[model samples]
Target: MSSQRYELVFSEGPGTGEDTVVVAPTGLAGPGGHPVYEDATGIVRAEISDRGEVRVLATGGGQNAVRVVRVRPLP
Candidate 1:
């Protein structure tokens, strides 16, 4: 499996530090190249796209807000 870091940016939505990023089960990958479904980050969730692009989802406080996912290249 492989590992990668992704930057979860809140483009449009509630103020900063208002929303939560939760881990969803979009059949994406994670730090390792494994089947990712969900995580225990409360409302803060994240997932990996098929192309290995990390897509984080914000929920709870900022669940209805828009999120910007940035995939960090392997170092």
Candidate 2:
């Protein structure tokens, strides 16, 4: 459990969108041992690879093409 925090910016288009805060070394891990994080509402889950690739695992209900476009470190 790392103390580092990160901001995951989600978008459905070409602009900024919803943001979620995730702590490093989350409880889950994806393929290749990447870190996985979920939104507070549990409506979105994403796996971020070491190369910064974001893979959306689940979108609770909506079938929109939601994706994580940016990841920023938080203090």
Candidate 3:
């Protein structure tokens, strides 16, 4: 098997603004429509919905399950 590098950034949020998080992924990049893995922080994966809502998944970084969170910008 081969190893690839990826960065996960948490761009905007209530208090997460100006907070550009960088994470080096040890796994492959997740494809769209595919499920995501969750982390201990209750954030398994993040995706933007068709309605422009950011969905977050919560996984314990172990199991194959994921939690989802929705985020959107307010006007």
Candidates 1 and 3, the one with greater lDDT: 1
Each candidate: RMSD to true structure?
Answer: 6.9, 3.5, 9.8
Q: Which is the better candidate, 1 or 2, if ranked by lDDT?
A: 2
Shift in Å, residue 74, candidate 3: 20
Candidate 1 lDDT over residue span 1-75, tens digit each: 234333344446455553323333545545656545344554545566556555444546535635553433232
Task: Please tell me which predicted candidate would have the highest TM-score against the true structure.
Answer: 2
| Of 1 and 2, the candidate ranking higher by TM-score | 2
Q: Please, what are the lDDT tens digits per residue for candidate 3 over residues 1-75?
A: 111211234544455544322222223334455223333343445444334343454445565432222332322
Q: Sort by lDDT, best first.
A: 2, 1, 3
RMSD of 2: 3.5
Error of 1 at 14 (Å): 14
RMSD of 1: 6.9
Native-vs-model 2 lDDT? 0.65
**Candidate 2: deviation at residue 42, Å?**
1.8
Runs in model 3 deviating more than 4 A are 1-17, 21-44, 61-75
